[model samples]
Target: MTAIHDVAIIGGGLVGASLAIALEGSGLDVAMVEAAPAGAMPAVFDERNLSFAEATVNALAALGVMQRLRAPTGAIVRIHASRRGDFGRVLLEAAEHGREAFGQVVVARDFGEALEARLSGVAGLVRHRGTRFTGFGAVGDGCRVLELAGEGPPRMRARLVVAADGATSGVRDALGIGASRHDYGQVLMVARLRAARAPDGTAYERLGDDGPTALLPRGDRAWGLVHGVAAADAEAVKALDETGFLARVQDAFGWRVGRLLSVGPRSAYPAVAVRAAALAATRAVLVGNAAQSIHPVGAQGFNLGLRDALTLAGLLVACARRGGDPGEASLLSAYVARREEDRRRTLEFSDGLARITANPGHAASLLRSAGLVALAALPSLRAGLVGGAMGYRGDVPDACRSGAAR
Candidate 1:
């Protein structure tokens, strides 16, 4: 017999875990499937940080995770963007945007711990860590029957199966949703290092002909560096000794952050923008990186994913309150419609910025520089850009505004 659930989330990473917490008291049986073993889950090796937009912070606060996060976090009060060897520059100041800070930064471990802790006490939630979803079948009333290799033939059923499994989602593949994939042929080298000069809560983005280098403030005399490098050189860079890697990074970043003293082991991520054909189908939906994975130029990936999760959760809860099946066509369509504009605009903005900045010729550089200058000089234009960066988009759910997961 199939043990039914209102929602069966196919990934238990940050997004999946947060979704579980959001639907806790809404009278829905929620279950999360994490592929890796409970003990083998990914952990932060070093000082990995995530920039949470103002709306995202408020959303997480509303979900009850922000209050649980400890101190030592950094808030991004200003963001600086400019192209190397060009006079084009744009700065986003929180005061100009009428925000205390564009967003707050938290270490990956801190955010993960807070999410896991809050999920622990959510009633009617089942977390199947160390389990993978082998297959699923369309069943009665638009519900799906999920197959797993755990305890028994529990045959879990769900009105909506959210595939938050990530960029390479098996659940998404099984659902026959094809994505438009653009492999930028670049790898993002991310690391933590001590800076010779202290960061005054300012994030710096230097656009290089090859790729972009971003320095995000992390308190305690450290900063997070995300450097984009050619795919062919990714392995070589990662294999380089500390001194060699820092030398390469310094060449790209220049003296923006004073100097790079020491760097921890670096992590690399391939850059790509994937847009699924559809976010919702008959009985299943996708969110987070599984739904749309964009380049990390603006740190828009996770923030966008969180917003998707929030919208889907809110729609589900609203449907449940109205005695409607969350997986029904009307419910699913509503979610897809709500998220369409934001997803399109974000993907375009990230992709366009990456392409424009990557052109090696002088003409492209001039155009981009002029655009930046124009954006910086105009108040309304600057406001629009900052709003987009701060996670404001179409039809945001109330939860996002408060940073609440629930």
Candidate 2:
């Protein structure tokens, strides 16, 4: 006989873990299956800092993760975007947004550890940390059997399956859902570095012919730099010695934050825009990077993923309380509807921005440069762009609006 759970979450990354925490005390049995080793914690720094806009900050605070982050992480009080050789720019100040700061910047590890610590207190949650999903099949109405490695035969069963398994989700593939993926022909270099100038809670973005470079504030002492470069140059940048790497970064980034003193080991990832064709099926759903992996050009990947988790959690918790099947088609359809705007708009924005900013032709360059200048000059246009940065009017999850219910 298979032990049953209310929900089986495949993937114990940030989004999956957070959703499990959110479902605590809701009378639902939750289990998270991770492909990694047991109790494996995420790294402290991944060369990319999580940039949380105000909306995301609120969403995190609501989920109770932000309060646990404490200090040593940084807040972004201002965001500046501009194009080189283009006489245009857009600025988003926290004051203008009527918030304390546009968002908070936290090291990926800080975010993960804080969340893991919180999960300890949430009752009725089981984490299958080291076990991975070998396969899954529909067993009966409202239940599915899951097979895991190094464990007894296919023992875990659940009414609903949530695949937060990430961009290359095996569960998604096993479900036989297809996706649309685009390789941007560019690579993103991410690093954490010590800077000569204090960041002062400011985030900077400069779009050049090579690519867009984003410098996000990290605490008061460090900074997170993301440099997007042509694919041909990616290996060279990643291969550079520390000194050579810093020089390349300094050259591409200029002295916006003064000189970069020291950089941590560098990491590089091929940039791509990916989207799962369907967010849900009859008895399962995909959230976070499992649904889509947008370019990291704007640090919107995780935030958007959080929204997916948030929305799905809310839908499940509410329905479960009302004696409804959390994974029923009705519930899943509602989730898909709620997330459409967010997924569509964000994908478009990230893809479009990357395409234009990376354009090398004189004509394309002229058009983008002029557009940037025009965006800076028009107050309405600037605010619109800034609002998007602050996380407004996209497909937001209901849990993002409501605190994780007790």
Candidate 3:
């Protein structure tokens, strides 16, 4: 007899792995499937920087994932936002919000390693590395038969399937979940940078004629550069010598962080906004980039996805404790209801920021400048923005709120 897992998660990336860890000791049999081999990092985890909101950090701490991290992370004490040719600039400080830090930045590779290390210790969790999720078929009222690429019976059963397979999710495709995509006509080039002065725990977001450029603090004098260029100009930007590229970045971002001394390996990806028409279908649900991939304007992508994973984990734990089916229609409905507001607000905020900052019209620029000034001058506006950026919107999951895995 094939052992049925209470939950089988596709795509063992950050979100999926985090979900498995969150459900540790929840009395549910969980399986995590990944195309990558065990202990191997994916391409997306190569040298990329991830910004985690305070709420996300708290949730990770609750799940014991934070304690497993061996790499040094950077703190974001303040966020400075400005645009070229704009009169006003806004600064959001953690001190004003009575927090030590608003967020933290971690290299993706380090995070992946941490997750991989911790996955082995989770009780009742099975990790199927190098396994692919082929598709699934309805088995019964609250179960789905999952097909794998490899040997064995070629199929297994699961009460719930969570798709965390990223933006181009095969599981989502097999399930016929449609996504709406919008290309921003921009490509973001990322690299490690060394500055003349230390970062001082501040992250910078600078908007220019081309697009937005973000400098996230990495270490004492190191930063992670996310420089956006026109899609047509990406090749030219990438073709530039290190010195030339640094010069272009400095020109766009100004001397906010002082002189850019050096740059490391470069990676570029086109910015696309992808949002699924629905988050849940049948016995399967989508999380992370699989459900909605948005522009990284406000650094909301992974943070939002982390919330999704935590929420689902909470719901699954509740269902298990009550002896209810994980894939029951009521459970799925409740999951959707809990997630709708946060997802909509995050997508709107990220998409709106990307669009408004990219607009070069005089009126738009003027309005943006005024808005920044208002954000700086108005305590209510500043508080709202800070709260949202800290991941304190909509329903707060128990796992994240209580910092407990229960």
**How well does each candidate superpose onto the true structure, as a TM-score?**
0.95, 0.94, 0.97
Tell me how far the alpha carbon of residue 328 in candidate 3 is from the true structure, in angstroms, after superposition: 0.5
Point out the higher-scoring one by lDDT: 1 or 2.
Answer: 1
Candidate 1 Cα deviation (angstroms), residue 20: 0.9
The better-scoring model by TM-score among 1 and 3 is: 3
Report the number of the highest-TM-score candidate.
3
Which ranges of candidate 3 are over 4 A from the true structure? 151-153, 402-406
List model 2 lDDT by residue over 202-235, tens digit each. Answer: 8998887767888888984788888878898887
lDDT for position 384 in model 1: 86
Local accuracy by lDDT, each model: 0.83, 0.80, 0.88
lDDT of 1 by residue, 9-61 (tens): 98888788778888878987788887656654444313466888887888888
Give RMSD to native, each candidate: 1.9, 2.1, 1.5
What TM-score should be assigned to candidate 3?
Answer: 0.97
Which of candidates 2 and 3 reaches a greater lDDT? 3
Runs in model 1 with CA error above 4 Å? 43-47, 150-154, 403-406
